[model samples]
Target: MPAAALKPKPLPTQSTAKRPVQLDLPYAPVAKRPLPAGRPREWYVTHNRRLKAMRLAIALLDSGVYVPNQARNETIRSTARRIGVHPPSDTTCHMVRALMRYTR
Candidate 1:
C-alpha cells in the first residue's frame, strides 16, 4: 500500500501535561456546566445529607412503605432509620421526609 493508503498520518505531538487532572461532576463548563464569564474555575460541592436524604427516599419506596411519590413524613423517617440514615432531628427528618414525598 502507498503511504497515503497507510494508517492516517498522526497530528504533530504537543507537550504533555505535567500534572494529572481531576474532573468534577454536575458542573457545566470546566466540569461541563456553565461557568463564570471570567474567573477561576468553580467546583460544585456535593452534600452528604442529600445522599442520605436520597437514600431514605429510595429505600422507603423500595420497601413499599412509601410509594414513588406518595409517602408521608412518618413513612420516610421510618424508612430512613431502617436504611441507616442518621436523622439530625425530628424536625429535619420531618422536613426531608415531606420533601421526599413531594419529589417522588
Candidate 2:
C-alpha cells in the first residue's frame, strides 16, 4: 500500500449552498419604557446621546455607509433627517463616527 495510491478524490462544491429562508415577519407592538428614576442629569444626557448615536450608526450601516470617513457630520445629519430624527449635534455626529470606527 503506497501512500500516494491512497489519495482521495476531491468533493464537488455546490454553486449555491443552502441558506435559511428569510421571513417577512411583523414585530409585535411594545410600549416604550421610561428612563429609570434617580439618575443624575448628566447620566441621562449621556445615555440619550449614546442611544441616538447607536440609532444613527444602524441607519448608516443599512444605507451602505460602512467606513467612518464615509459618515461625515453632514451625511449623518442628512441621514437623521431621512430617518425622522432631529439633526444630530456635532458631538453626537462625532459619537456616531466613533461607534462605527470601534465596531469595525
Candidate 3:
C-alpha cells in the first residue's frame, strides 16, 4: 500500500450540548440566634483561652522560645505555664502540636 493510503482518518469532532441555566433566588432571613447570645459565657471564655494558648504556642515556636519535640505534652504544658495559661487542656496541647507541625 502507498504511505498516504496507510494513514488513518481522523475521528469526527464531538458537538457540545447546551447547559441548563441556573436561576438566582432572593436571600431569605434565617431564624438564627444572635452570635454572643447563641453561646454561653463560659463557652466563650473557654474558647478564648484555647485560642490564646494556640496563639502563644505558635508565637513561641516562631520566636524559638519553645521547641516542640516528641515529648510534646511536657513542652505544651511548660509553654502554657510560661505564657501564663494555667492548666492547659488536652485540646490546647494538641493544638500546639498541630501548630508546631504546620510551621515546619
Candidate 4:
C-alpha cells in the first residue's frame, strides 16, 4: 500500500478547549485584592454581597458536587473569570475552604 493513501483524514477544528492529559504546577497562587481603607459601611456591605454571590455560585457549581471532585479551585477561578474579576476578597477563599472542609 502507498504511504499517501494510508494516511488518515485530518480531524475537524474544535471550538471547545481540550482538557490536558496532565498538569504540573507548584502550589496555587493566592489571589489578593486591596480595597481602600476609610470607606463607608455601604462599601463594606456591597463588597460582602459580591463576595457572597461568588460563594453562592461556587456552592452551586456542578450542581453541588462535592468539592474535591469538582476541582473546586478551578471551578471558583472560572466562575470569577466569567464575572470578569478575581476572587473578590481574601475572606471569600477562606470561606470556601472552610465550607469545603466542613462538607468533607
The most accurate candidate by TM-score is 2
lDDT of 2 by residue, 26-103 (tens): 688689899999999999999999999999999999999999999999999999999999999999999999999999
lDDT of 4 by residue, 2-72 (tens): 99999996644344336433435658868987888999989998777556654645544545545644545
What number of backbone clashes does candidate 3 have, counting pairs of residues 3 or more apart or in separate chains? 0
The 0-to-1 C-alpha lDDT of every candidate, in the order given, reads 0.57, 0.93, 0.66, 0.60
Candidate 3 error regions (>4 Å): 1-35, 40-46, 62-71
Q: Using TM-score, rank the candidates from best to worst.
A: 2, 3, 1, 4
Cα error, residue 17 of model 4, in Å, equals 13
Error of 2 at 57 (Å): 0.3
Candidate numbers, best lDDT first, in rank order: 2, 3, 4, 1
lDDT of 3 by residue, 2-63 (tens): 99899996644334325544546867967966447678888987777767767767656655
Question: What is the Cα-based lDDT of residue 104 in candidate 3?
Answer: 65
**Candidate 1 local distance difference test against the native:** 0.57
Predicted candidate 3, C-alpha RMSD = 15.0
Higher TM-score: candidate 3 or 4?
3
Candidate closest to the true structure, highest lDDT: 2
